[model samples]
Target: MPLRPSRDVFITCAVTGAGDTTSRSDKVPVTPHEIADAAVEAARAGAAIAHIHVRDPKTGRPSRDLELYREVVEKIRASGVDVVLNLTAGAGGDLVLGSPEAPLPPDPAGTDMAGAGERLAHVAALLPEICTLDCGTMNFGEGDYVMTNTPAMLKAMAARIRELGVRPEIEIFDTGHLVLAKWLKDQGLIADPVMVQLCMGIPWGAPDDLGSLLAMTANLPDDWTFSAFSIGRNQLPYAGLALAAGGNIRVGLEDNIWLKKGVLASNGDLVERAVAIAEAMGSRVMTPGEVREKLKLERRW
Candidate 1:
């Protein structure tokens, strides 16, 4: 049977992703207040969830500060937005290696590693409905840098998230990531009703092509919740594709800035547009409460 269409789909606004996008667009929120406001605005624009990453208020670069994340969560709650808080647990470890000759110490200019416990400190306190856990490590790009996350590190983080009663949005950048993710499930490191985010088109990782997407999708457990997104220009377009593929969509400046060439967008603008796109396709956008039920998530208790 064709998968029945639901009245509404779920929208996750990746409010303030920890990328270098701030350098390109002034509209990207910097301070915690600004980030929280962006999230609230996304909620008002019909986003059911806010996938978040914090930054140093001064530089707007990504930061793993627990205090900053706390403020964002508290402000959103105080404002009474029904958005599900999906705090990021992908920070703390970024290892940049030196030339092939010297690999032991890593290049100081490119390395940003952290203790596993410290890496997930924010999620521990906030206990958001969802948090991201990158499943595998990869040579990030041509640069002398790498986004390092070993199997041991992933298991450690997943264990903690499970203990804290937080849902881990397994982020798989490639087919191998899915391999490790499934293994994690088999090992009972994560619970059933598994959730994953198929990260496509990330440089030096997964290409944003249909084959790559299908390969990852094929490996997902027969029954699991999933969402998908691409960076830069493909962000919104892929949202529709993800929905059509029997998955959810993720959008926001964390992945893209311009609504079009030469036009910068606010988080709300992009979210409102996603609602229109999804609805136009005869698909319904789910609310946060609806997502809670669909994922069997326990709300703040």
Candidate 2:
């Protein structure tokens, strides 16, 4: 496909992901207060949206606790920052199996599978302007762990998110995930003005090459709004790549811990770098209000 490029782009700062990154970087937010502060800082740094994931305050491990989410949302709202909130509804589907010789029984400590209601409990309660819907199940990273999101689960979650009036950002890790996204749309589970997030450069999934990224974007429906990101070092470069591919950008410590070769980055630092990249490409970084208008989001404090 040709390089259409996005003239008007929006940046989504993924504040803290459900990854084991805290050990590597001290900038990763753990408590709700810290996470909320990081999100607000990112918004102030020119991010239109804040894609958030909560962690256990004590252990620094990812948590889906309703109260943690509640505190984070309340803090962000009370901060009076005008940034779109996009929560992660992609948790509770972690499936970690045993050894290859004994794969029947899954590892309890690493596996965390839940029903549709439980998986989307935080989203339904908070009703953020946007929540992610991971479109497919895949082997995530170097482990026996598989990110498990069955078809039935995705359909049910999509229906619920639509009913809640919160837009579901279809997260695609591979080209096949786009197939499931279309299937959800065909089943009427997903609504119009669809938004997608192209996740690249993960093991056993799509590579972070330009050709692969172009292929993924080419398969997307023309009417759908989209953003793209790759993990670690490529995260910053993908900001420009996303704009060149005619999609928005996503960045933060969640996807990348380093701002430069040996520098640990805060969420604000990442957002600042992304803004610079977008502006240098002659693309306008959109504001939160503009994004809400474009996506037709419903904001509730």
Compare the candidates by TM-score and give the number of the best one. 2
Backbone clashes in model 2, listed as residue pairs:
none
Best by lDDT: 2
The sequence of per-residue lDDT tens digits that candidate 1 reaches over residues 1-301 is 2443334578889978887899999999989999999999999999998999989998877888999999988998889778888988878678877778877788776577997889888888878898889999887767767777899998888888889888888998888889999888888889867888888999888898877777677667779888889988899888887877778888898999989888999999999988988998898888888888877787883
Per-residue CA lDDT of candidate 2, range 1-301, in tens? Answer: 6779899999999999999999999999999999999999999999999999999999998899999999999999999889999999988989999988998799998888999999899998999999999999999777699999989899889999999999999999999999999999998899889999999998889999999999998888999999999999999999999999999999998899999999999999999999999999999999999999999997786
Residue 62 Cα positional deviation in candidate 1, in Å, after optimal superposition = 1.0
Name the regions of candidate 1 deviating beyond 4 angstroms. Answer: 1-8
| Candidate 2: residue 105 Cα off by (Å) | 1.6
TM-scores vs. true structure, each candidate:
0.95, 0.99
